[model samples]
Target chain A: MVPVLLISFIPLVRGIYIGFTDYELGGQISFSGLENYRIMLQDRFFWRSMGVGFLWTTVVTALQISLGLILALLLNQGLRWTSLYSVLMLVPWAMPPIVRGLMWRQIYSPDTGALNLILTQMGLIDAPINWLTSFEWAIPAIIVAGVWGEIPKAALFFLAGLKTIPGSLYEAAELDGASAFRQFRHITLPMMKPIMAAVVSLSFMWNFNAFGLIWILTQGGPGGLTRLPMLAAYEEAFRYGYVGYAAAIGNVMVIIISLFLFFYLRVQLKERTS
Target chain B: MQRLISWILYYKGFIIAGLLAVLIISVYIAGEMAIRLESDEIQTGPLRFLSLAWQEEAVAVVQEITQDWNQAHPEQQVELIQGTWNAVHDYLITGFETGDIPDIFHYESAVIVDFALRGYLADLAPYISDEMRDDILDVNWASVTRPTGAVMGIPFLAESSIILYNLDLINEAGVIAPTNEDPWTWDDLHIAAKKLTKDRDGDGVIDQWGTAMGLRNSANILMNQSIAFGGSFFYYDEQGDIEVRVSKPEKELIGNLARMLFVDKTMSPSGVGKSGAEMIPGFLAGNYAMVVGIGSWARQQVVENAAEGFNWAVMPPLKAVTQNMGVNTQTLSIPRSCKRTAIAMEFIQFLLSSENTTRLAASDWMLPTRQSSLEDPRLQADSTGWKVVTANAQFLSTGPWVGLPGYIEWKSRVANPIFQEFFSQRISLDEAAERIESESNSVLARYQVRGLKW
Candidate 1:
């Protein structure tokens, strides 16, 4: 337990200290205090990255959770090959994130992409769309790729929750003349509350720190439209050598994530008490 | 059931032992990866060297020369290892801290000053013989020399900045073509940019731009523009002090050129932060009239990607600066701690020889550093922009940036911010200069040591 806590806090402590100091790869280091934070606040890229991160998390979580719940309910029905379907649904989750990102990037490529080829062949569009290059379509294209990658894990959690429900409860509801929708509302959601809470919290954290997908896809470009916060941190630290500024950004991320977790826990506690 | 559970618990020891055995094997395998050591048996024999060049052709040329050298010497053999561009700096810095740097490695000309200041690089004045030094071009040697008056490495190549123009666009614009003797000035370049800017179908959108300067590495663009205006950006004064002549020039030359981003509107404001993606594809599609890039790009992109019917013209240096500035990205250096310094030095000489260096340049489309290599019949045989490239490489001036340890940080803290502030009209030139000077001095103060000159 001691080792676990120490390992957990090491990154936090390191990031905080590094944020307040000027760290160079081969040069000298000096304490800069809130100077790094001040510079970060003034940086337009940092703020732009924050906005992109929020949009990315929001869209990915919403789509993932909704699709997951729908898929879980469909699979929970006494459908044929339900076990095979559940196993097949996990393919995306099993595949590496970087590989998934690469495959999607190819599909969305401006020149000679499979998506455009299919669309043009079907006569859905006369000309191939420059999906990755165009400003209007790039983010949406990335979001589609992200949602595809996320739905599998969320579905697994919901499916686990679906299994824990007793068949007798549904039979009792049927005898009481409750409709299928009412049974789900009254029994299914209440029973799945704890699992849903856990899944949602995990999903929020996972999506917040999502780096590989964005890095592999757009590299935060077409003028930094798809730049996530982590990419901004990477550019500042490695490319620009603004270690202090990057640390400040990291600190800001921590504060934001902690606040999100606090609110999530508050809701969980209130629900438990009620 | 109780009996079966008891048996399972009794066999737990075997299970635990098996798991620990697997864990030990995995750890052993992982540990062995860090132990990838070449035989130390030959440490007293053959010399080992590493070349961190990304170009495959350059690597091949270096290998060919090493084989020939090893054949003649009979006892001395050399080893060359390749590293990625990103890894080169990190590996060197890490190596210096841990004392693991190779016998010789390619150091970018820009970062050579800092490495030398840190005492990570060996001074070539002792290793490089005078006759051997005389063979290298003077300006090329000057570019690699430290501010403290010591040569760090042999000049491998000269990569100068030149304007790559779309031939079809120039012909259609009805603008008088730039002759070899009378090259276009910054003013001429700007006028051409305006003529090239057009909304072909009158859609209130520019389908073609006159020019697009590299936004990511805009400092190079500013340096070239400053040279056009007869100003030096950063250089070592006679006293070995820093002189930022271009940043606060008499004409605000660098800032004036930066204003072209917004004032002239030749480059699109929409692609400011994201430059690499914008510049490469934009030029390839006939969307830009001209681009200011190095000789390597002229050979690789303009020549290779020239669409059928798309021919390119090579324009000479603009007049704001009389001296043409050439930027060399990577320079080779030998680490001081290496035991194979002698063999490494010999290999370095062999690598820089006219025949080998020419083959290296021809394969990679890189400009040859040697004066003798520039006149090679093979390079001159090409009717493409190779002739103009060689001419540009010959009379080029290559110092000004690359001399200070704080230059990289300054580009972000001082140069980029000044350009962004100027382009936005958020601050006056006076304020920008004062801020840049104060900040850069503080930055240099931290890096400056008694032995290290800033």
Candidate 2:
């Protein structure tokens, strides 16, 4: 356990140290002091990406968890073909991120894409929108792609938590004259609090670092509308060869996620005490 | 023993398998490296070159040259590894990082600027005999030479933009061909575009159009239009840093001309109901009368369509832009890490030799980089399409694109979006220009890569 943790921590430590230094891979490294971090503060793209990261996580996590919990609640009712729908819905989550990204790219393609073709025929739009190219549409388009691949996993997690919730509790609430919505609020919400916390945190972290779908669909384009911290970090490190600066971006992402986890924990603690 | 086995099993076979695979593969690679290193001591072996020539035909042409080199000099053979354009950077970067760069590799003009700035490419000034250097035409040399006074790469192949017009469509419109001696101006082109555009089926929608300009990746095309109206792109002063000198007239020219294509509806929309790659077919189908394309596509699509009795002609850019000028250069250079520099140089010299150049020109339509090969009789004897490519070779200019270290990235990242916004009518010309300047400046400031002044 110690060895495994230490091994992982080594890269983290090294990355932190490298972020402060002027490390250009295969080149010379000098002490750049706070230059990289200072630059990070001023970079509009970095801040824009941070904003994007926040929006992406909040929206995707909320949508997935809410949709997932609702679906799980209905499925928990022991409805017909519940197992079949659950199994079928799991396919997207089973797909690799790269495949999901590529599949979405084709679907969003402006020319002869299945989505546009169908939408045009259905008279939903007068013209095929450049979903991946329009600044107004690029972020939402990326979110849709991310959520399409993620909602399934959220469903499975909630479903798992659903199984743990004793059915007798719901029966007990019903006998007390609590309505259906009230029963859900009283029995299901309280019972699934810990599971919800887990799902939200996991989804937040995962969506915060989502790279493949954004990269494939928009590549941080339409004037940096879809740029994320990960994409920015990658461009800095690999494309521009600013190893330290890229590492700094990575470190910043850690701090951002840490804050999210902090707020999440605070909420959970309040829930527990109450 | 059970505990040890359990610990091993806990890893899911990843560690043991990974280490074993690495060891075996490293040993095989080491053995191959040992033989190659040993051979290098006795003789210069096959000089390997990496190039972005993914297509079979392109690779075959390169192979033909290497085979000839091998036959001529049995002592020193040549090998070429072909990779797609996207993978070329990865292969080169990995090689450079590991100190395993190829002897010779090809780079496009803009990328050469970045590679040269980072000191990855060899400064070829010390190389090549004075006479050999003198023989390379100045224009072709400009395509590879750094504006910062570094001769980084040898120009191997190049293409410049040409105005490809469907002659049949023009004649059908009762419009006489612009005299071959004196071509149409931008005003004339605009007028013709307005006329050529028609609702053929009376469906109240444009069917046949004057031009088909792809708005998605159309900076170079738009820049060329701007240049035709006497606009300037990138230029630097004696200080070797970029000097913002884009003229007001040029800015207006670019913005107004781009509007002619986008807002004015003379050209197809960015994805105008089809992909950018599909434009040629659309043009051939009489959907568009003209398109601004390079010699490569003009020959492949326009000229090839002639066999089906669809004749096409090339028109020079309008006045102020005396000739077709846009970014097009495929060059060869040795990386600094290359261990086989001498052999690579030999191969390059052999390639530039008149005989090989003639052979290459015979096989492909690439504009010859050598002065002696320019007058190669085989070029004249080739088909009308090839002859058009050859004749345009002289007046074809390449520049205004290779003025910065991060030039290609600037174009792809900064300028592409600005142009996209412009085409989409999402931003005004002034706003687009401001964004272009600031974004490009920000990138340059962030990277701190240096560029040279011409």
Predicted candidate 2 versus true structure: per-residue lDDT over A246-269, tens digit per residue: 999998888878877886788778
State the weakest 10-residue window (summed lDDT) of model 2 chain B.
B445-454
What TM-score does candidate 2 reach?
A: 0.85
lDDT of 1 by residue, B187-251 (tens): 78778888988888786768788876555435555655465455656666788777564354424
Clashing pairs in 2: B148-B452
Q: Kindly list the per-residue Cα lDDT of model 1 for residues A169-242, writing each as its tens digit.
A: 99999999999999999999999887787777778778888888888877676446777998888767665455
TM-scores of the models, in the given order?
0.73, 0.85
Docking class of 1: incorrect
